[model samples]
Target: MPTTKKESLQFGLMMCFGMVLFMTIYNLFLSGFIEAITLMEVIKEFIIGFLIALTLDIFLVGPGVKKIVSKLPIDKSKKINMVLAMSTLMVLAMALFMSVFGLAISYLHNGNEDNSLLKDYFSTFLKNFIVAYPLQLIVMGPLVRYLFIKFVLKIKCNCNEY
Candidate 1:
């Protein structure tokens, strides 16, 4: 079993990885197709909210979850599975966090209220959130974790023997 500190570190890394990957994917597709949110606008919004959600998940959410999970009677061999599960929870948690953060940021940046892209593309906004958030939870979180543990982690271990 990894130490608490190690697990915490791993979880933080995974959380950040998930957040950035999800944001990049969402921004790319939304900007390319939706036209409501431009590349620059996506970058700005992502910059403002991404770090906030990442920090929240890493410092606040991840550690709290670690404490809880530590108390569970699960086997140590299940660490990878546990990390994947926790990452999914973290994504869901951050989705709500980012949505609220996005709303607040939109209000602050473009106080024109009705003239913002959000107002112009309300349906697009809703679609993006509904689709992206769940997709992250379903695919990015667990699948990425699995790939990391299976492929990337294996490569790293093998390469370290050189």
Candidate 2:
């Protein structure tokens, strides 16, 4: 989808921002902060999460997903196939890595006294993947693509162009 380096960066930033914002809220709710969540708190968590997620996405997940998608037997000529494969893999990888980051932060702050680090990590990963997969595939992916094309690329529709 992104043909240029600048477009790639833009796309990544947009995706990371949306994903981090939603996921942070979802995670806070999961942790029973439903009524207690503050805007400033969400902003703080989103900032930290966004930085880490963007770094992981650019350096690791993006390249690794591309590599994995390339090796898949799906038809490369079909843009839909490529897009689906890439999105699925990217979501999977990001969810996996971010889950670990989340657990580390939780442990650092709360201190894992139950010795259930492994269990908690897996549970977190599963819960994150469940929500993240659909959130990306159904919502964020299409939304980001449309925004990038409309705003970043400045592509006008024929119906609206005078």
Candidate 3:
């Protein structure tokens, strides 16, 4: 429930970071431990994942979250409530949009053309949604918002007076 473009951008940035971090952990847990021979590869994955996530966040999730929030019966005056609602909605939106994209990424990474993404897609989606919803709702959302509110949004630095 961002009322301004700046807030929307800030929210998107937060999600972008959260997604990149989450995806890195997911990717590592899936296959990186055995496959990665060096830390450089992990760093590369992180950078590439960050770029991909930022693009997806700004292009897909950010606007979609705003649209979904707009449809919900939310109280704009209640910041905490709005944050919770938006975080929940964002998790749903991410699950809906990013799951397939994640499948594609996995497909590319694994070089598995024989196995269809359709197979076990539901199970994968459910697992991802279940894991991500709690992480987003309980950890990343509040942490990011708290940091933004405490240090970024509420701070104003003015110098060199007239």
Candidate 4:
């Protein structure tokens, strides 16, 4: 249990926001929100995307990319590599999540093959990925990480050492 009311509140808010964000993205491309998005579609897309992103992040970027980045001198290049690495990882994660989830939703909602809504949704997903990923990394990732870290540190400092 969270000791601080603020922590509990923030956790709840993050969850709510995340779900809303996910649903909004799904509707904008896949379903258009004329009807409720199905749970199966949501779960499929989220799981597939998350798995793809996690796998890519761990296997592709985690070791090889870091080693290459680590070789750079501690200067602007290093900073650039750090930013690049983080951004790339985040984008991949987001892409994977959006793709699987979007596909599932679009497939579920679309009635006719001629509609091609799923394909269009995929394209939109990629387009949105290109635009939104940088923003998420630059804004959401740093902000949330910093907040959580600071919150944890504050809690730790407040603890009575045995």
Indicate which candidate wins on lDDT: 2
lDDT by residue (59-156, candidate 2, tens digit) is 99998998889899999999899989998898888888899877875676567879787899999899999999999989999999999888877753
> Model 4, which residues run further than 4 Å from truth?
1-31, 34-80, 115-124, 160-162
Computed on alpha carbons, the lDDT of every model, listed in order, comes to 0.60, 0.86, 0.69, 0.55
Clashing pairs in 2: none
Count of residue pairs whose backbone atoms collide, per candidate = 0, 0, 0, 3
Residue 40, candidate 2: C-alpha displacement in angstroms: 2.9
What local lDDT score does residue 52 receive in model 2, on the 0 to 100 scale? 92
Q: What is the C-alpha lDDT profile of model 1 across 66-151, one tens digit per residue?
A: 67666666674775767655555555555555655655654554454566655644543464467666666677656666765676
Q: Candidate 4: lDDT of 157?
A: 67
User: Best candidate, TM-score-wise?
Assistant: 2
TM-score of 4: 0.51
Runs with alpha carbons beyond 4 Å of true place in candidate 3: 1-3, 32-37, 74-76, 157-162
Q: In what order do the candidates fall by TM-score, top score first? A: 2, 3, 1, 4
**TM-scores for all predictions:** 0.58, 0.89, 0.76, 0.51
Tell me the lDDT of model 1 at 20: 61
| Better model by lDDT: candidate 3 vs candidate 4 | 3
- If ranked by lDDT, best first, what sequence of candidates would result? 2, 3, 1, 4
Candidate 1 Cα outliers beyond 4 Å, as residue runs: 1-34, 72-88, 109-133
